[model samples]
Target: MGMQTTPMIEMDFAVIKEDFSRYLIHDGAILKVKIVVKKILRTAELTAQGYPAGTSIDSVNAVAAIVPQALKREPSKEPWDPRRDVGEEVKFEPQEEKWQEYMTTEGYRILIKPVLTKVFRYNKYNDYGEPIYSAVIQSITNIEKLGTTATT
Candidate 1:
């Protein structure tokens, strides 16, 4: 993939009342900009249909809709355990050709670690009565956060 380049964006807004300068910044070339939004969502109508109560809220639980549901995990023997450590990894006849081919087939960049870690919860009511866990992937989006900076 090619490297990414920054873009020049123009922001236009009207003055609601006053305090206009704080919203805009005049610079040499507008090198960097950080937007501080009052809120992502605009207020719904002050009134609903009849007596105009006020813009109370559009949503009850914000995080409930966005935050991913916790993934369940089934218990399993981990690949690596300190207690079960095999006395120092014994060297075997190196598969040089196969090793090189594997590395080439799957580039290092494609083997990066996962962004989110898995959570495991133990349960003791299965057939054998040991511990078991079930897990699944979850997506993260729609987060409220500070704006980012730009470089030009």
Candidate 2:
């Protein structure tokens, strides 16, 4: 007869910042300012990847139990904390742009860009061997700046 092993659970969360701001400077002077306003969303999920068929409800509950704690554990608030963040991925997109007479008076136009960044760290290790190695399947999303502000 074959032996059965307890299913393993993996949990992770994403940090979403819909609103943020940055600065735009020209000739050491402020031109215009941009403000971002959105909801901050944080989400998490738990799963047992290799669980066999007919898995008991209790097993699922057990896995879900850790979600609360995981959700509460927000990735380090410090955006560049080396201890927690290993690397980063950045994406920039022009969401909208407008050139108004009022804005032109300020000597610059208002440009709003959506910036999405993903921060992550290696969680799984290959083995305790000479050269340590790790891998990651899903990464945590970190929203930092939503908009830019500059004065002229």
Candidate 3:
């Protein structure tokens, strides 16, 4: 019997983008990036012309015509609930202890929070029977907001 050994695979990766400045900090070095979550998709669907049984094809056949279909989801309206505690959180910002100091005399606050932008809707469902959403905070921007802001 011969001893079998697995072959090593050499993997090389690169970040191809128009600009990579945001990823670098003061020292012109890449910032520490943490991958919080990783997901692997195992499900996929294929849409092609359905060829029924007893369908014959020529070896030198012509190019198959591809068709496109449009799919849309109906927007849901809020149910008539007079006493709804809270609807849903569209954006989340973390506050610091000195958040109060950022407030101006006219009750305007200028605090530094991550600029969140919704990437896309996730496929997961929540307890409220609604589709879970996800977002990404790429960079920080200055924003002057009026009125009191909730801190938690």
Best by TM-score: 3
* TM-score, candidate number 3: 0.21
Order of the predicted models by TM-score, top scorer first: 3, 2, 1
Local accuracy by lDDT, each model: 0.20, 0.24, 0.26
Would you list the clashing residue pairs of candidate 2? 20-146, 22-147, 30-151, 30-152, 31-151, 31-152, 32-150
Per-residue CA lDDT of model 2 for 35-114, tens digit only, reads 23222222222234321222111110000011122223333323343455454322223232221111212122222232
Report residue 87 deviation for candidate 1 (angstroms).
37
The sequence of per-residue lDDT tens digits that candidate 3 reaches over residues 1-152 is 99964332221222111111122222122222212211111112212422111211111111111111121233334443324323343432222211111333423232322333322333333344444333344433232335424365
Summarize candidate 1's per-residue lDDT along 1-152 as a digit string, tens digits.
99964332222222222111111111111111112222112122223322112211111111101111232234344533434433222111211111000011111100111111222223322333322322222222121112313234
| TM-score for each candidate, following the candidate numbering | 0.16, 0.19, 0.21
Give the Å error, residue 88, model 3. 20
Model 1 misplaced regions, further than 4 Å: 1-102, 105-109, 115-128, 137-152
